[model samples]
Each structure stands twice: as C-alpha cells, then as structure tokens.
Target: MPGPVFLEGEKVTLRPPEEEDVDLIQCWMNDPSVWRRALDVNPTSRQQCAEFIEDVLQGDDGVHCLACDDSAPLGLVSLNDSQYGPDETSRARDTELAYWFDPDHHGQGYGSDAARRMIQYAFEDRNFRRITARPGSFNDASVGLLESLGFTHEGTLREAAWFRGEYHDMLYYGLLREEWNSQ
Candidate 1:
C-alpha cells in the first residue's frame, strides 16, 4: 500500500504508517535502550507490531505517522485520543501528542521537526484548539523540547504512572493555537 503523506518539514516528513514500517518499528519499540522512552516499551513481537499498524491505519481516535528523511524512518509521531465538544465545530477539539524517535537518531532534531509539522497540521488542518502532552517528569529531553515549542506546563500528575519499575509524575503540557500562532 502506498503510504499517504501527512505532513512535511525541512528535515522530516510524517506519513501514514504502512506495513513496510512495521519491522523498523519493531526494532525500535523492542530495543531496551530505545523503548525506555516509549509510552509502552514492553517486548513486542512482529504480530504485535502488525496489530499496532492495524490500529494506526484505522484512524478512529488518532493518527500515527512515521517520520522519515532522505534515507530511512526516524521515529513515530502520533496525534491521538482526541476529544471534541458537543458539536463538530463547537470549538473544543483537543488532542494528545505522543512521539518517540529511535535512540540512534537522537540529537539530530528529527523529533523537533516532526513535532512542529504535526502541531501545524493539528491546528490548521484538523481545527484543534489545544494540544496536550503527558511526558514522564524524569524525561528532561522531552520536557525541554515541549517548552521550547511554546507548550506551557499545565500541571503534574503525581505518581500517575509507573515506568522503569518506579512511580513517576506525568507532566501535562498544553499548547494553544494562539500560542503557536504567535510563534
């Protein structure tokens, strides 16, 4: 299947995840060093990865895009778990953003590029007024990136999640359309 392009950036392009990406995703998600930063890093099999592709293709609650440049896939960026107001245009459309890049690709700014494009897509194309992110408090890189993108720290959910066998705070960040527009 031809993977439909979703959003593009100078250094990164986000596209609808296709079956061809499953192997790459499996390697990244199952790699211990890489998976630690993922939302769920459990050991995953090829079948599980295929199932994930299926879910992403369904696109009911969200969309998952693979970030790539000239050579290969760099990461997975997803905008999902959306909630809207009473009416379609009632102005309450909000969504959660989740992204993870392979550890090998870290420090190359792929995440930043993909995030900027995704935020633009959510605001201009999807009509989302607010975008939120829940990053583990200990993830300094993530927190720094979100802040740099003008995503304000909204609050902290104390001990709201378990990661690496310990309870960790979940930091909530919200970026309003106006905030992005001003940027």
Candidate 2:
C-alpha cells in the first residue's frame, strides 16, 4: 500500500499515458513492423486505440508509462496483466513487463533505459518479488535489451505466437528483486 509510481531514467522518462499519446500509439500499433513483433494482427481503429488508452489510464492494476525524452514521444512501457502469487513464496508477487519504442528510435538505448527504470519501480516501489518479460524469439533487439538488463532467459514456448506469416517462439525472461538489487 505504497504511493503511486513514476519512473525516470538516464535517456528516457516515463510518465502516465496521455491523450496526445493516443495518436502516436495508434500509429505504432498500426505499423506492421511493430505489430508483428507483438503478434498483433487485428487492426485497431484510432477510436479503439483511444478507448484502450483511456481504459489503461483509468486502471490501477498495473502502471503504464509513456517513455519520452525532451523533444518527442519515444514509446510505451507498461507493467500489465498482473497476477498476484497465490502463496507467500517469491513467485507470489510478480508482474509482466511490456514495452516498445518507435522503430525510428531503435538502437538509441531508449527501450533499455526505460525498461530499467520500470523494473526499478516494480521492485523498489511496487514490492514485486519478480518481474517477467516475454519477447518473441525473432525480436533480437528486445531479447538483447532484456538480457542486457540482467533478465535471465528462463524458457521458450515453441511456435506460440503467430505474427507475419508463421508462428514464432515466445521467450520469457525473469529478474528477481534481490538479484536486481545486487547488481
């Protein structure tokens, strides 16, 4: 029962998703390149995207932050679809971390910096014992970023996600609170 969470990093700062971000988010979602990475095929209209953002802004289950710099929007980072651990063990407190930066902003370290900030918030502020990130096996950049953040590659679900044409393996990475704190 702590206060709300706001994450700020070296190259990027994460704020609550805003109305203005709807347009940019819509563009990202509609882009085939971005959607394929997330295994999203159905097209969402601008209005649907706006409504989704509104829903996200209203919810409290997880924190969804818009990663940005001084000039323009970079991408989104969210600790979403959280499921509390049934018991008191370490696995009982964890959440799923998801993030994406515009393809144009790729390789600038924004995604990695933003993810590091979010994971920090998850452990120190949210009291989560662990955080899990699932990225497609073909998404080398995302996998590398997660690995760079000290997320250990736990497992892969073979042909679990269908994206452009064929099914792709889904890779899951995990980082424990204590492990991150030790780093």
Candidate 3:
C-alpha cells in the first residue's frame, strides 16, 4: 500500500513513498520523457528506488512526496534544502523545489496543484524564506509552470547542463515568502 498522505491539494495528495512504490518510481526514473528535463538523467534501478524510500523513511533532510489522486500516484514532488552557497548555514532559510509527473498526466493541472501545495508548505509551514527551482532551458512546460507559480526569473546558467548529447542552459527561478504571500 502507499504511505500516508503528507499533504492534500485540490487535485492531488502528497504522500511519502512506500516500499511497494519502488517499481513505479524506478519506471518513472528510467523514462526518458520524465528524466530528460530532470537534473539527474541517470537510470534508476529497483534497488536504488528502494534505498531512496528507505532514506526518506529514515528522516532524510528533505521533504519527498509522491503526488497521488484518489486512485493512484501521478508523480513525485520534493522540497530539498537549497545548496545555494558554500555551506549549509548560508542556505538554512531556502529550499529548492523539484517535481516530475507521468507523461500521461501532463497538462492536467496535477503538477500545478502539487507544486502549489509544496510551495505553501515550504514558505508557511516550514518557515522557509525562499524557494528556488532550476529547470533546463529546453523544458518549456517546466519554465511555464514555475512562472505561473509566481516565481521570478532570477538568472540563467548558460550551457551549465549536459543532456541528450549536448549542453543546455539552466534557468533559475526564485519566489520569496513575501512574494508568495502577496500573490
């Protein structure tokens, strides 16, 4: 069975990963349609998926959740400590947002709903001052989603990422708690 719901949204529920979800997670991790835009493009084995679940269960530093609706899981959403500086102390008040959904579920508003909830949790519940997201320049959907969520285009790292046989730029976006509250 899936783990308990960690947060609920209009169209999705965020839950911690369970051991039974290893196969599905591994499948998503290895899917080119999903990983092509993600930072880590390497394929994930079932064992690695299980280990990730174990780490999450054992109190990992980040909040990792599976986005699910009534019937099944649609994707993964996470708020990890933003490594924006040379040390942890410099990034204590920031978190980085990341998510990916099943290709079949794209453009259905689930990703937006899940991401909105995670942003709320980061800023309001977790007391984070800012949340950041770095999407590849080629990922139009991701860039659009981040923009639609009230994130500002902070900057871009030109040719900072290598994927799909060539280098791609990475777009940086940030939303402060004040900005989110004002929206």
lDDT (0 to 1) per candidate: 0.83, 0.82, 0.87
Candidate numbers sorted by lDDT from highest down: 3, 1, 2
* Model 1 lDDT per residue over 3-69, tens place: 7666789898888787887888899879876677665757899998889788764456576788988
Clashing pairs in 2: 85-92
Give each model's clash number.
0, 1, 0
TM agreement with the true structure for every prediction: 0.90, 0.90, 0.92
Q: After superposing candidate 1 on the true structure, give the runs of residues whose Cα lies further than 4 Å from its correct spot.
A: 1-4, 83-91
Error of 1 at 73 (Å): 0.3
What TM-score does candidate 2 get on C-alpha atoms? 0.90
Please identify which of the two predictions, 1 or 2, would achieve the higher lDDT against the true structure: 1
Candidate 2 residue lDDT tens string, 57-137: 546657788888864778888887556643335456888899877899999999989999999988887788888999998
Residue-level lDDT for 97 in candidate 1: 89
lDDT-best of 1 and 3:
3
Top TM-score prediction, candidate number: 3
Q: Quick one: best lDDT, which candidate?
A: 3
Residue 88 C-alpha lDDT in model 1: 44
TM-score for model 1? 0.90
Which whole-number lDDT from 0 to 100 does residue 40 have in model 2?
79
